[model samples]
Target: GALVYQYPRRTICKSGTSMRMECQAVGFQATSVAWYRQSPQKTFELIALSTVNSAIKYEQNFTQEKFPISHPNLSFSSMTVLNAYLEDRGLYLCGAREAGDAEQFFGPGTRLTVL
Candidate 1:
């Protein structure tokens, strides 16, 4: 079975700092995994590929550096966010899927709170 698991489930960091979040794709090959941020009382905003935005502008960490999607033959992926701010606080979801597959498996996600 294909599954994506994100650790920490939740995290709290000081404003103007960095935090590292990780995701593990298991049981099957993943061609891509998307990281998203769910805003408070708002829909998820695009953080990056296979991932995030409705009226959302992604930060560099998500758009430029692109937390590399795990190869279809691999099962792991990671991303780190630097300089977390109040606007950056939200639920981070990881969505995974394989090539030619329509179903996307989602991880429980890591919620971030910037102090």
Candidate 2:
């Protein structure tokens, strides 16, 4: 079975601070990790997609400068939200996908709270 795990299910940070989280892929090779943000209002946004052996692609509203991702190998990945603000508050998810699957298996996610 394929699974993605994320640490610190909830986090609270000062308005001007930053937070770093991790993602782990288990039971399968995670060729790609897609990061998304779910807001309290239920809006969703695709942040970025990090694929092994390929260039990382970030969505229009997101940039590497703001949400930098790291894919060290086929089974793990991570990302950071720098200079956290009110707008940065949300549920950050990590979706892991293998080579043949069009759908991704998502982690429970880290709930971010900004003061």
Best by TM-score: 2
Q: Any runs in candidate 1 off by more than 4 Å, and if so which?
A: 50-62, 65-73
lDDT of 2: 0.91
Question: Each candidate's TM vs. the true structure?
Answer: 0.78, 0.95
Best by lDDT: 2
lDDT over C-alpha atoms for residue 62 of model 2: 96
Q: What is the C-alpha lDDT of each candidate?
A: 0.70, 0.91
Global local distance difference test of model 1: 0.70
The RMSD (Cα, Å) of candidate 1 is 5.4
Candidate 1 per-residue lDDT, tens place, 1-115, comes to 8888998799999998878777777886666666778889999776765321122234564653433333233466666777778987888887777653558788898888999
